[model samples]
Target: MSDASRHLDARSWKALRDKSPEEVADFSTHLSQPCEVCEAFLERSDEDDAFGVESLADEALGSMSTPREDAVGWARLRRRLWTPRRAWLAGAVAVAAAAVVAIAVLPPVASKEHEDRSWRLKGVAPMSLELSAVARLPDGTLHAVTEDDLLPPEAVVLVRYRASEVSDAMLVLESPEGPAQMLGGYTLEAGTHDLKEAGELAGVSLAGEHGPRVLVLAAWPRGPRSAAARDAALTQRLVPEEAAQARLRLRVEPGYVAP
Candidate 1:
């Protein structure tokens, strides 16, 4: 893609959200050309009802007291909306509205530790689902990890998940070698849950080996399946067919230090 095309892709969501004449004009002009990627992005955005979520996010940010809060709120909202390859808009809207309320009422914290430990939305998937990961830094402070964030070596990562309904879930880590099962044959109750706090499992440590790793959460309806069955299914397909799956990709760059 050309530089201009890349810019258009990155700003397309913003244009739709802002509805400013200049952005809209630029977006429309780009659309007039024969670009399948842009066209598909627009279609997906429409399907996801990006405008409604954007408006909710704007209102939430407007209620915040500081630029820092606004930035954090917007970043969370963006990940919830735009990071997912596929999403159901109804659930997304509900989540956005809830976030608006949460952000509006939450008191500002002056401590960096408190601020850093705030739960961050890391990834989203279909079925109105989300996955969050937080790492305990060497200094004993908690840090919510994002796709772009570099995790410290041997960092202990805890996870929390949200689901619209009760389902069976499998957590897997995909590396260059193959898929390694982190947690499997587990049941996810409806709503948000902290895996470690719930005593389902402790936590997983990201290896010091540097590269990219993908955390995959595959969920399906409650059904009769044996451990062997689940493992076989995962081996054949990382994500089951017709199942809701969320993926968080994390990159570990050598000698990179977290700020």
Candidate 2:
């Protein structure tokens, strides 16, 4: 069992969600102990699920039209909804499917003006990394933001990443007005992760910032370096020759209002 004082990590939660018998038994045993932090984390995970489902439903409704687009949208929705613990979302899934079918008969809407601004650095490495950002609205909903979007001053920006291999990762923020700031260090286990959920930092706030800012994800194979060494490498904009890295460039315009 993990330390009672520590909350469960993403891999453990993923295993539990996937109905791994050992993981479920272990988590159940852990919860039987006195751990307020894990309990609070459980509650927050449930809340995040609810909010995530609603946002995905809205996205499916808005984006589905042609058969190809419908397939893509439904695939994404199913990936989120069909998790073992999320069986309760069956009803929601049916409703979303019905709505998608209804919309499929309509003519396709034009694509949005904003292009996909997210990109990976061109390189050959053992792992691949991708970075995306979403804004947490005041209502606790999330809106995916791209480079073309002008973020609101008070927006809570949550960074999400996808990695192709298990690695040690660091998130660094570079602003035109300041030096590179290390947001947090993380151990990414070969999948997509929301930095807020996976790390101690709640979320990145762009409240007082402006102009183009770069968020960098530098990741190398795990277990080879100390935290101090990782920090030092990032300070010099250097990584191991085998590291995988990605960057997201964002602009914060304080006066611009996001819809």
**TM-score for model 1?**
0.45
Computed on alpha carbons, the lDDT of every model, listed in order, comes to 0.53, 0.56
Candidate 1 per-residue lDDT over residues 93-196, each given as its tens digit: 12211221100111112344434422211122335456766655557556677765687555655556776767666777667765454444466778876543
Model 1, CA-based lDDT: 0.53
Quote the RMSD, in angstroms, for model 2.
Answer: 21.8
Model 1 deviation from native, Cα RMSD in Å: 23.4
Best by TM-score: 2
Error of 2 at 26 (Å): 60
Q: Estimate each model's TM-score.
A: 0.45, 0.46
**Model 2, which residues run further than 4 Å from truth?**
1-125, 196-202, 226-228, 234-242
Question: What is residue 4's positional error in candidate 1, in angstroms?
Answer: 99
254 Cα displacement, candidate 2 (Å): 1.2
Task: State the lDDT of candidate 2 residue by residue for 112-207, as single tens digits.
Answer: 331231122222245567766666555545567665467765666665667676666777777878777666567776776555322232356665
